[model samples]
Target: MIEQEQAAGLNRQQQEYLDVQGYLLLEGVLSPSEAVQYRQQLLALAAQEPGRINPTQHVRWLVNKGADYRKLLLHPAVDPWFRHLLGDDYALSTLTSNVVRPGAPDGRYHTDFQDRVPEPLPEFPLTANSLWLLDEFTPENGGTRLVPGSHRWRRRPPPDLAVHPDEIRIAAPAGSVLLFNGGVWHSSGANTTDRERVCLICFCLRSFMKPQFDFVHYLSDEAYAEATPELKRLYGFTAWPQPVDEPAAPKRRL
Candidate 1:
C-alpha cells in the first residue's frame, strides 16, 4: 500500500496522492474472519486487564496476540510501499501493541517529528503511522480522526468539534490499515460505543532514532530471552550497525 516506485522517474501516483490528500486508505487489507479473530483477542485482553492501556491515557500492551495481528505487521503488500516511501537504507519498527480502549479521551493532534525537527513546524513530515484496525472503526467509534491533506498545510490540529461534527464519521472494517504522514494534523476520535475499539498503531521511522516504546524492556525477560533474531529485529534489535552520519532530510511544505 505504501511502497515507492522506481522506473528512473518520480513515483507519480503515491507522491501525488500523498502531496494532495495526505492519507491513502487501503481497503480489504484484512479478511473478515481475520478481523474477527483480531477483535476477539484484543477485546478479551483489554477486559482481562484494564491496566494494559496507556498508563498516561490510552491502554496498550506489546505482546504477540495471535497470527492476524502479527502477520499484518510485516505483510508483503505493505513492503513495497515502505520500500519506496522510506528508502532501503532504513528499517521498520513496531511499538508494543497500542490498545486504546473505549472512553479514552480524544488525543490532541501533534506532529510525530516534533523532537527530531529543529523547528516546531516543518513543511513536510518525517514520521508516518500505520493504524491496524482490530475492530470495526466507525465514525462513531473511536476511529482515528484526521484532517485530510493537512500534512501539507503545516497548521495546528483543530479541536474535534471544529473539524468533525457529530454527523461526519470515519469507519473501516477490521484488517484495514490507514496509512498517513505524521505531519498531517489529526486526533483520536472519542469512542462512543460500549465495547472497546482496539488498534496496533506502528510509527515506522527511518531507523535513525530511539523507538517510542523500548521493545526490549516491554517484552518480559522470559519472552525476550528465547526470542529469535527476526523477532528481536522487529522489536528494535539490529544485525548490523546503523548509519547516522548523514544530515537529516529536508522538510516539506504545504
Candidate 2:
C-alpha cells in the first residue's frame, strides 16, 4: 500500500503507475544542457579506459571520479523517490554509466538482482535502479525494453518467454530519468543507429546487502571529508558496526 503523502516526490497517478508497471519514466527531469554535459563527462571517463569497453557491458564506477559525478548521485529530481522506496538507511550500491555502442548486441532480458541469487525470488523491494538517459532513447538507438509488471513475478523469465508480449520499449528524449525495482525484468534494445547510446545507472539497495563497489576504500579522502552527512552514509562508511550508545546518525570517524 503506497501512501500518497509518503511518496510526495510522485503524484497519486504516478505512484499507481509504478505500483502496476514496476517502473516509471520521469521525462525531461534533466535539462538538455545537463544531458549534454553528462554525456560528455561520461564519454570522457570512458575514453580514459578505452581498452575496458566491452560490447555488451561498458560500465565504470564513478562516485569518486569528479564533482559532477558526485553531484549527480544526489540529483534532486530522483533522489527523493529512491529514499521513499528504499528507506532512509538504503545504500547507493553502485553508480556507473552504460555505454552502448552502435551495433552492440541485444541485452538479455533479466532482473538486476534476482538472477544472481537462487530460485524463489525474494519479495519486496530490496534494490532499485535509477537510469539517467544522456542521449535520446529510441528503438534504433537501443532504448531499454521492460516487461511491465514482471517485477512481482515469482519465477525467473523462461527462455521461451524472451519475446514477451507485454514488454514495451521506453522511448524518451535526452535527459529523461527511468527508475524501476531491481526485480523488474528489463534489457537494453540493440543499437542499430550510427550514434552511441549512453545512460548512467545508479543501483541502490537496502543497507543490509553488499554493495557492488567499495566506496569506503576507493573514495578520495578529500571528497569523503567534504561530503554531506547523507552522502557519507550512502557511500557505505556509516554502514559498518557502531557502538550501541552512539546515536544512529553518523558522526565522527568509524
Candidate 3:
C-alpha cells in the first residue's frame, strides 16, 4: 500500500479515477509556450528524418534529441505520482514521441507490455505510462482511444468491436498529461484534420523489466553530467550490483 505522504501529489479524486478507470488526465500540466516549443522540437526532429515518422508508431528516445526532453523526464508533478505507482526503485523504461499525421491510419488497439510479460499480472502495477500532450487531442484530430477499466482484465481484449462500448476518446486540450497503467488497452484514432497530432510518452517500470531503450549508451556525457541524482539512477548508473558476491570457500591450489 502507498503511504499517505508518498501519494501526496495525487488528490482523492485523481487516485479514485486511476483506481477505477486505470487512467487519469491531468489538465494544464504544461504551459502553452512549453507545448508549442515541444511540438516545434518534435517537428524539427521529424523533418531531419521524415521517413522515420510512421503513422501511429512510436519514435523512440526523445532524450537523445534535445534538452527539453529532460524537462519532461524530471517534471516534479509526475515524480510523486510515479513514486506512488511504481515505488522508488522503478526505472524509466522508455521515452518516446509519436505524431499522427493528417490522414494517418488508425492504430490497432493493444496494451504496452502485457503481451510480452508473463500471464497473470500481479495485483500491483509493475509499469506506468505518462503521456505529455503536445497538441490538443480531439475526436476529429485523432485523439487516443482507451478502454476504461480494461487494465484490470487478465486477458487480451477481443478485436471484434470496431468501437467498444467502454472505449473513451480522450479529447483533451494541449498541455495536458495523461497517466495510465501500462496494462490498459488503447490505440490511436485516425486523423482526419489538416494538421498533425503530436505527443510524448514515458514508460517507467519496476527495476526487473528490461527498458525499451538503452539509455546508458544513448545519453551523451554532457546529458549524463547534467542529470539529477534520480535521473542518474534511472539512467542505470546505479542499477547494477556493484561487486559480485564472493565464493564462500577459497579456490583450491591446482
- Best candidate, lDDT-wise? 2
All models, RMSD in angstroms: 8.0, 3.6, 4.9
Candidate 3: tens digits of C-alpha lDDT, residues 32-56:
9999988888888777775686765
lDDT value, residue 249 of candidate 3: 45
Q: Which candidate do you rate higher for lDDT, 1 or 2?
A: 2
Cα lDDT of model 2 by residue, 16-83, tens digit = 78767889999988889999998988888887886787764556667777777787776778876777
List the candidate 3 regions with Cα displacement exceeding 4 Å: 1-3, 159-161, 241-254
Model 1 spans > 4 angstroms off: 1-15, 52-68, 96-105, 113-116, 120-124, 155-169, 216-234, 239-254
TM-score of each: 0.71, 0.89, 0.89
Report the candidate with higher lDDT, 2 versus 3: 2
Which segments of model 2 are wrong by more than 4 Å? 1-7, 116-118, 159-161, 242-253
